[model samples]
Target: MSDLPRLSSSRVPTPFIAFAVLAILSLALAGCDGQAQEEAKPERPVLTIKVHYAPQTPDRSFVGTIRPRIETDVGFRVPGKVAKRLVEVGQVVDVGQPLALLDDADLKLQAEQADAELRAANGVLAQAQAAENRAAELRRKGWSTDAQMDQAKAAAAEARGRVIRAERSVELTKNNLSYATLRADARGVVMATAAEPGQVVASGQGVVRIARVAEKEAVVAVPETLVARAQGGEAHVSLWSEPGKTYAAKLREFAPVADAATRTYLAKFSIPAADDAVKLGMTATLTLAEPASERVARVPLSAVFNQGHGPSVFVADAATGKVELRPVTVKSYETRDAVIADGVKDGENIVALGVHKLDTAQKVRVVSSLSF
Candidate 1:
């Protein structure tokens, strides 16, 4: 009763059995932990994002050319040989400036002869008048007949008429002589010269081409599809030769009918002032600003994906760090960009690159690079 029986040597101890149960439990727990870790891990994908931004203003682009506001073909009123050329090509000439001279020797001689004839006619008229007065006096004194006096008066009248005719002829001859010299009607630059010294030109023949130097204009032919974009307002113009230099112009007018051959409308813009650098036939580019509408977000054209039904973009939510496919409406499409009218908000991040390979409701790692 006082002493317990000795335990058998081959019997397992209680401490050892407790240790085996604990070891089995530990192995089971480790397997469960491994499964949970595998399930908790998320599939990460590489992606790029572009934030939606509000456009400061809308810009419209157009192709155009530069031209003079007033152009004319200069010619002489009378035909003659070109005796002298007064102005050279590209030379600026003022009003009343002599541009060219024609051979006028014959005209000058004709004018001188007409003047001499006029003087002779005047002398004959004076003599006839004196004789008519004497004949009237003789008729009153009964020395001459009334019919003879009347005839003398008729002769004097005829001589007076002849003198008037001769004076008019002299004036005509002088005018013809003056016509040989060609003069500029307005201040302009000589664009082209069709006649040279010693070349015979016909009346009204185009001898020189000139463009007015006071007012300059820009002429642009807009396609039918884009003609509606041009409005009567301010526009920015640039020259191809001069990069980064811009000039301000006002839209003057647009032709009502489109050109039959080109199917484009002609638009004219008035430059503020005459610039020496600006010349006729120079190429130019015009940029007109579009009217302001409701504020909307815009993104690059590459960021937009056309999914048959509509346009859409991938948006990454910052709160949950998740990417979701969202549909958007395109307000306008430009050369290299698109303006989103709806389906996105300001400051929202959008997937720009690697959007084609993404799935709906996927987690993405945003890169630091930004797109224009």
Candidate 2:
């Protein structure tokens, strides 16, 4: 009995040994499963993005020209020689300012002649009145015949008619004399001068060109595709000469029809009266604001992947954490971004960086440290 106990008694059961090995294997498997669960977590993708929301405004810019608000062609009212040009080109003038003078020597001579004729007519009228009174007195004293009194009355009536005609001639001459001086009807700057000293101008001939100095306008041509968006909106204006300064203007008018040659619509913007720095014919840039109702998907210019078939972008779904190849139609592109006309919405996130390696339906882990 003492030798048997020392000799390890009876041999252990094979099934029992097998069960012990199986228990150890189960414990090792459990530890491996715990490690796998931790390692299976996904890594996030790195991206930079701007949230898609209602666009604050789509500010579009276009080229334009500076033009005068009001342009006028100054002309003479009567025919005569231009004695002198009182204003020069680019001269600022006020209302009722004399712009030119016509020769009045002939007019003065005519006026003098009319005055002399009026005085002569007055003398004839006085003589006729005296003769008529004398004839009436003689008839009353029974010294003159009725036929003499009738003849004197006829002579007095003819002389009074002559005096009235002479007075009208004098008034007409005075009016013509006053018309010899050409004057401006409004405050403006002279843009052109067509008359000079000793130049003969006919009535209604343009002697100068003037434009209102206080009101300025910007004239721009909008593309036919964008004309509808430009009507009745405010515009931002920048002067070419003064690029740093900007001003606001209101869109006042747009042509109903498009220009035949250029296929663009003509539009005008009313701008504040700029100082002398803003000269006529200076170039300007106009920026028109688009309405907020137009919704569009946009992305950075770099995010777009160019393919022979069409343009596309990389989209990452948050739920699945997978990248997808999405086709997009580009509506328009600006300096740093592009506007997708279709095929996207406001809430979806897109891969902006490292998109070149992405494929459709590929699983990805979003790394928290790299997520933008």
Clashes of each: 0, 7
Could you tell me the lDDT of residue 368 within candidate 1?
51
- lDDT per residue as tens, model 1, 1-372: 659776675687889989999999999999999999977756454444555554346666777778888889989898889999989999999999999999999888999999999999999999999999999899989999889998999999999999999999999998999888899999998999999999999999999999997888889887876665576434788888785888888878889999999998889988886477777778888887655546666687877877686899888765565877789888898887788878876667787766677777566666553544
User: Which portions of model 1 show Cα errors greater than 4 Å?
Assistant: 1-57, 139-149, 229-233, 241-253, 290-372
In candidate 2, stretches whose alpha carbon ends up further than 4 angstroms from where it belongs are 1-57, 120-168, 291-372
lDDT of 2 by residue, 72-138 (tens): 9988777999998998888989999999999999889989999999999999999999999999999
Worst 10 residues of 2 by lDDT: 363-372
CA RMSD of each candidate after superposition: 9.3, 9.8
Each model's C-alpha lDDT? 0.82, 0.82
lDDT for predicted candidate 2 compared with the true structure: 0.82
Q: lDDT (0-100) at residue 303 of candidate 2?
A: 77
